[model samples]
Target: MSPTKLLIGQIFIVFAIMVLGVWAATQWCAAMLGYQPQLGQAWLETWVFAIYRPWQIFAWWYHYDAYAPEVFDKAGTLAGASGFLGCAAAIAGSLWRARQASHVTTYGSARWAGLREIRKAGLLRPVGKFLGTYAGRYLRHDGPEHVMAFAPTRSGEGVGLVVPTLLSWTGSAVIHDVKGENWQLTAGGRARFSHALLFNPTDRRSAHCNPLLEVRRGADEVRDVQNIADVLVDPVPATDTSGYAGLSDSIDRHTWQLLKGVALSTLLGVGTEISFGDERSDLVRALRQSAQQNGARAGDQIVGRSLDIPPTLEVRPGWPLRVLVHRDVVLRPWRQGGA
Candidate 1:
């Protein structure tokens, strides 16, 4: 049954037991006093005694007349026993229902993703990122969603998931291999199709990438250099003022600003050689100067060629003989070609 209906039923049963106990005690009291029992009077007495005169029942039992019949005593005992049992049952049922309500069951509610579902999600693609193994088969995730793995230290995460995935996956991946095991195991296989580089700071063989090189050299040069400096000099947030945390944070910020300034200066100084100009007008002026120089060179070549030609040769018209000779030379090949 639903919890609501079950709770309502329990309450009704408890109330019924309580009323029955009161009625049994009232009946016994009426018998002892040799008076007829009245249900209305019993209910009125119950309400008054239960609320304002709650101690009356115990006081009556302690000061009851010894002349009371044995049957009356037995009825009173039965009433007390029934009331105790009813209260206990209510308390126990409430606790049991609360426990059941709060309890969570994993059975039939949660299940691992099956092969068909995985394949349908395109996680079984050869180029997909490896998630883990399911039922002795590798499971991959091809979607763009992020995946995170949580495992305790000394687990088989590297051997089982990382290495296997790196060996089979053809796409690019960034791995955080603390022990350098992934590089040793999968480096050769990956090198066949991709350029693999390890960036371990402690190791001399690791490839180095200068963060400042990534900073763009333009109007936003300072901002870009500051961003790289921020990443390079990240400090832990201060948790308390008792230790060097505040001092460290101050030093880090100072160092970051100093590094940013130095980086900006270095890039600005070096970039001048490659940078066309600082402003659009400067670039336009440089382009105009280049165009003028190219035009001057072309003009100089034309003028030189014109000056190199003999003036008398150009003034006389002897082109008919030259044209006749060229025509004869062209026709001589066709005349001599015939066998």
Candidate 2:
């Protein structure tokens, strides 16, 4: 199957498992209280809240009359639940087919050239993939001046939203499957290598759910979150006042720092994996820069953590900071001490 379809499938499976699990649980609870479900906003709210917390059910029940509760029959929650389940199933089915085509790890073979070229262009196809490490020649970080412009979906029928980054490697490759997973790079740090990969999280549009790639050496880590820059460029088209104003200048110092992590990760892919530490940032300074770079319409006045900056700012610009990733898989396992 194609890599794109496979990616859609994995995303579908992930969402389906979450949504269905919640739907089933909600159904059971409603049955106890003599209710089913509905095809209303309440159903969505209910499903979201239920999976997040048990107290949410009570919260929904309180406001049911105004939203979903008005439509749900106390003894007929099953119908609503069934409708919700059906949608989840349908989305899963659609994505299942798409996902089947996206898991291609190898891309240099003669047959993969055209597809690999499209991916190399760094253009995203709307609702896309998770982390697909093709380890191919198509992966390279082009400066904003060279990166292509791809339109994100205004709405979606497939996998919500996604960004596909290609990982270009010159040395080794290390991947952070960060669903709370840790990665480690030990020794071999001197090997100069770089890698680029695409990132597409289903909830990419949300304030949360940032699935990006970070390559860190010590506390100094660089990251690439494609959306951050695009959103900044959204307000108006490029004006001629400044060279950087154009889409051509979309990549900035922040972006350069972000890619450091990408280079470190792929460098360690073939060697060993070991722990390094995470970077700490000055929220005040980072907020100022992030907001400024993002066209002054960024996060709340309340400053927050961002992976785009380096850990410590006291050091000179050339130094690196490293962190520990607990789940580093160095040496790829030994087989009976054989060579």
What are the lDDT scores of the predictions, listed in order? 0.64, 0.40
Clashes of each: 0, 60
Quote model 1's TM-score: 0.37
lDDT tens digits, residue span 1-339, model 1: 457866998899888887777666755555455443321233244532422122234434555546554645775787788799799879988987887664334353455766788778886666666777667766777677987788898788778777887988888888787878889999999999999999988899899988877777668777887788777775444433366443322222245656665665555445543444545687666865675556556545544554454322121233232323534344444556585
- 114 in model 1: Cα distance from truth in Å? 5.2
Model 2 vs. true fold: TM: 0.17
Worst 10 residues of 2 by lDDT: 157-166
Q: TM-score of every model? A: 0.37, 0.17
Model 2, 120-202: lDDT tens digits are 65633332222222444223343334333354544431122122231122344344434411111211222334423324355
